[model samples]
Every structure is written in structure tokens, then in C-alpha cells.
Target: MCGGDFMSKNPEEAMDFLSYVADVSRGWDEPTKGEVGKMKSQLNAYNAKAGM
Candidate 1:
């Protein structure tokens, strides 16, 4: 934690990062159904954060 990189300070930024992760994970085949479930959970979480 020497460069303010490990800890997250912005909710929007974190969501953006998680969105990118979810997008890339969409192309993978590992974990099959698990990945989809996790992705959906993340999406719901983001939406709830935005109060949508």
C-alpha cells in the first residue's frame, strides 16, 4: 500500500473495474454456470448501489 493502489477510495471506480472484469469473464468457459451466477450477482450489486 505504498502508492494508493491496493485500497479503493471511489465507488464508481470500483464498479467500473468490476464491470470490466465481468465483461472479460463473459468470454471464459471455466466454472461454467458459476461464472454466470457471479456475474449476475455483481450486476445486481452495482444496480443496487445506484439505487436502481
Candidate 2:
């Protein structure tokens, strides 16, 4: 909780938003492995923090 309640305090919402971004990004262009990995890392980190 760095600096308390960052962008999204809701875990489910954050995950949903990330999933949506991934889907939308796919339509825009093919996301590289690094880009996908970054998103995954973010979700995993958030999930861990939220104890999901």
C-alpha cells in the first residue's frame, strides 16, 4: 500500500481492467512478449498484494 490506496484499490477491478487492455491492445497491434509479460507481472504483483 505504498502511499496508501494507489490507482485501483480493488483487485478484481484491476484484473478486469488489465484483461480488457490486453484484449483491446491485441486489436490495435500484436503485443510483444515483453509487453504481455509486463502486464502479467503487474497482475501477479497486485494479486499477491491483495492476497488473491
Candidate 3:
């Protein structure tokens, strides 16, 4: 695992965006949380596609 993996092209900006996403996602509960987690997991595929 590397910081670069989660770090976007713009380090400062990406951390900020990730923090915002975390804050919003944390508010979710149960069924909604699971659904959102699934979507977020799908987005994880982007890392593979980017060859990270």
C-alpha cells in the first residue's frame, strides 16, 4: 500500500475531497450505508484501471 495509491493527481485537493466524502458517507446508516459503500467500492475499480 502506498500513499500514492489513494492520493489523487493533486495531493492537497484530493485529501480535501476525500475528507468531504468521508464526512458525508459516515452519516449514512444500515441499508443506505451498504448501498453507498457498494457504489464507493465500484469506484475503487478506477484504481486498478489507472494501474495503481
- The candidate maximizing lDDT is 2
RMSD of each: 15.1, 17.1, 16.2
| Candidate 2 colliding pairs | none
Task: Report the C-alpha lDDT of model 1 over 1-52, residue by residue, as the tens digit.
Answer: 1245525547777677768778888877566688889999999999999999
Give the Cα lDDT of each candidate. Answer: 0.75, 0.77, 0.72
| C-alpha RMSD (angstroms) for model 3 | 16.2
Ranking by TM-score: 2, 1, 3
Against the hidden reference, what TM-scores do the models get? Answer: 0.42, 0.42, 0.39
- lDDT digits (tens) for residues 1-52 of candidate 3: 2256664447887777788878877876545777889888878888778887
Instruction: Compute the lDDT of residue 38 as modeled in candidate 2.
Output: 97
Q: Is candidate 2 or candidate 3 better by TM-score?
A: 2
Counted clashes in each candidate structure: 0, 0, 0
**Which 10-residue window of candidate 2 scores lowest in summed lDDT?**
1-10
lDDT of model number 3: 0.72
User: What TM-score should be assigned to candidate 1?
Assistant: 0.42
